[model samples]
Target: MATATRRSSRLSSLAESISSSAGSTQTPNSRKRKQSPVATPSTPPQKRQRPAKLPAATPTPSAVGLMAHATSATKKPTNPMVARLADPQTTNATLLSPETSRVITHMNVAAIPSRLPQPSTTTATLLEEANAHLIKVDERMRPLVENNFCRVFSPEGLAEAIDPFESLASGIISQQVSGAAAKSIKAKFVALFEGDRRFPHPSDVAPLPIERLRTAGLSQRKAEYIKGLAEKFVSGELSAQMLNDARYEEVLRHLIAVRGLGKWSVEMFACFGLKRMDVFSLGDLGVQRGMAAFVGKDVAKLKNKGGKWKYMSEKEMLELSEKFAPYRSLFMWYMWRVEETDISTME
Candidate 1:
């Protein structure tokens, strides 16, 4: 009986060992356990492979340089929406909306300058170049600028004509709209004109039926305003060169004297059309906004209280532009761009 009991105990131990071995070798009974990638969540997931990495972003280049290259390089924009879109690398760059893509492709990204003063370049060397560029942006832009204003200009020459026309146009559109809304609408306008106009000549523009101009996304009044200017140019009432030939103040005075021409409008014509350095139209909201932005504030109530902008009087805006000197027009242009436009302009 004692021998029989020992053999039974030994058999029980052997059975227990066999059961443990079978359980360790076998798969789980559940279907999920059998098929799941990892039986349970023990680690974070790895990202799926992407097709490719995006091109590394470049340091902001000068808008003037970009425009000089882009405008001269192609008759039509490669991507028209890029100018009005937000920066691709910015936190806010990730966005949704039908117009978002359009904004990134249709606008003139070259309109604004991106570079600033760097050790490799100097104020004097860039001054001459900026001065010359200023002359081309607008005639009145010349008056608000100075011949000797090379100091501020060259170091910050890229600021000279950054966003030249688009910025002015943005200011025109942004009177009461949010920056995003203004950009969306502005993209439509740029897409319509730059794409469809095919560099409409002054005469071609003058007689464009109001409907045709409107189709290009301009409001009736704006269309008329542009047409009226065109007609004036075609007729002897106004000559575009008159602004070029006249002194800076004379240019401003003459431009502002036009019935529809205001300080802001004249400033744009000067900054963009003429490429004047050191221009700041106090009447412009974008200038005000840019001023606030430069000072690092979001519409501070004490704007006037701070002496920084105040010290830059109407004349000083020109003089301070001189500190930026010949690059004033570029500065005005880029700052204007910052108000409502972006580098994503498609072309």
Candidate 2:
């Protein structure tokens, strides 16, 4: 009975100790705490801070003027020459005709300046005026003008003028041959006619046998060309009086249609025969060499490649010649002088 009683007490004591140990390990706030709803005064939502506005930009007077110019309803020029002249940057060259421009473009010529200088009242004569203007524009031209004296306007120079037929025929004969050889051939050609005339009339030449013309040192093709030119003259398709009164463009149009009369030939006739003032020929090798020399280019290096030069182009030639406008023929004469060549021999 005593053992039973002891076992029951020990069991009771062990059960109590386990219960107390578990209670000791338990957290004081085992349940989750509820969040408090504090009644603090609610602040108004903060507004976004705006950036300060910048002041409007004021345009400068020059900018305003440019804007006005841009908006203006001014009429623009239709012609290229006129348009170039309207530009303030353009300062030299005469206004070329459409025909002239076409030829230049076809030849790959340099650009000519569009604006011509106003005529000076200080000079007495046209030649004098041209001289003064050329000197004023290019100082290099002073020595050329002073030394050469522009005999092209003098009576002695004018006295050397031949008729249109002679001039053209002479040009044809002179093609691809030395000056002395051409003179020799021309002498022989003139001898073929019975009359004492300096040159044979186109009427007399039109009916001559090609074989007979060949006896005068003319190539078979050249003979045909000469005959064709004669026939045109005989048919009244070309006339001296008409050519004399026509403008340079008209002259170019008329002569360019003739057989064997190339642009270079026509240009030569205009410069030496017609005495046209504003004409220039980039095809002339003498002129090219002279121009090359004038601009400080090495003349020996200016080799002819195909139809163009090694150093200078036709376009460059035109640009270089632009400053001597309205008197390019005279300028060409002086260019020959620059090379120390006799311009008369070229004729």
Candidate 3:
């Protein structure tokens, strides 16, 4: 009976200790626990919130834009030709012929100043400088300089003293003809002008019949070409002063419009007539042959795709000639000599 009573007392003490521990651990609001609300057919779901975007970055300046800015900052002076053309009185469209007007309208104003010749220097000084430059730059040119003296700058060699009209007329007559034949025809043509005027004036030539021009060994087409050239001169569309003062390219644009005056003819005029220094004629057979010989290229072996013999090509000739610039006219004069003489033999 005493053991049963003691067991009941211990059980009561254990139950009281457990109750006190649970009461000490519980929160003051434990009786009011919060619950998440369930979604119903009548209720809408909440949307998610996103982070805000940052601002865009600025771009760096481009090369072209920088170039444009620099160009504007350092403005170039206006070309004299451009300034002259800008004047209504100077470049009157109504006063100009259709051809002249067209040429003027299409002119590259920015390029005019660069193309114009600088102030004249003595021909002897020019030749001396060119000779030294060519010999120093190219070993092949050494023998050519030693063997031949450049006479293109000499009074007798230059056409500066000759009438521009006569020079141009001579060029037209010489086309497609041998040197001897050309000289003969030019003599006959000048002889038609009667008493001692050297050569007929443009005014005189303009009115003459094409049949009269043909009497001097000219073809029908050549006769027409000369007559048309004369008319251009007579009309004041072309003049000696204009040609003398104009840039090399300007002279080309003006003359190439005339009949029988192609790029080759204009190049000859620039070289021999105006005595321009830096001119090259890729079309001249003599130049082609000379260039081939100079570079040790055998024309027979240098054939095109068709296997036909070809001389130095225009591209190759241009690339080679670039080394002798500012004196290429003198270089071209020597090329003619290369054909007549064996330059390789000379020390």
Clashes of each: 54, 3, 0
Regions more than 4 Å wrong, model 1: 1-197, 258-260, 284-347
TM for every model, in the order presented, reads 0.38, 0.57, 0.57
TM-score of 1: 0.38
lDDT of each: 0.39, 0.55, 0.55
Report the error of model 1 at residue 293, Å. 10
Which pairs, if any, clash in model 3? none
Candidate 2 per-residue lDDT, tens place, 1-347, comes to 12222322232233333444448553322332444454546955455434243221111111111211100111121322211111111112121111111111111112333374443321124466667767887999988898887654332333232356655666677665655676688789889987644467788889999999999999998798888888877787776655545667887888889987666556656665554567787656557667878889876554545633434677888998888887787788788678554344333
Global CA lDDT computed for model 1 = 0.39
What value does the lDDT take at residue 132 in candidate 2? 74
How far out, in Å, is residue 259 in model 3?
Answer: 0.7
| Model 3: per-residue Cα lDDT over 211-296, one tens digit each | 99999998898788878988888897887656655666777889889987666556656665556677777766556667888888
In model 3, which regions exceed 4 Å deviation? 1-120, 155-160, 176-184, 304-309, 341-347
What's the lDDT for candidate 3? 0.55
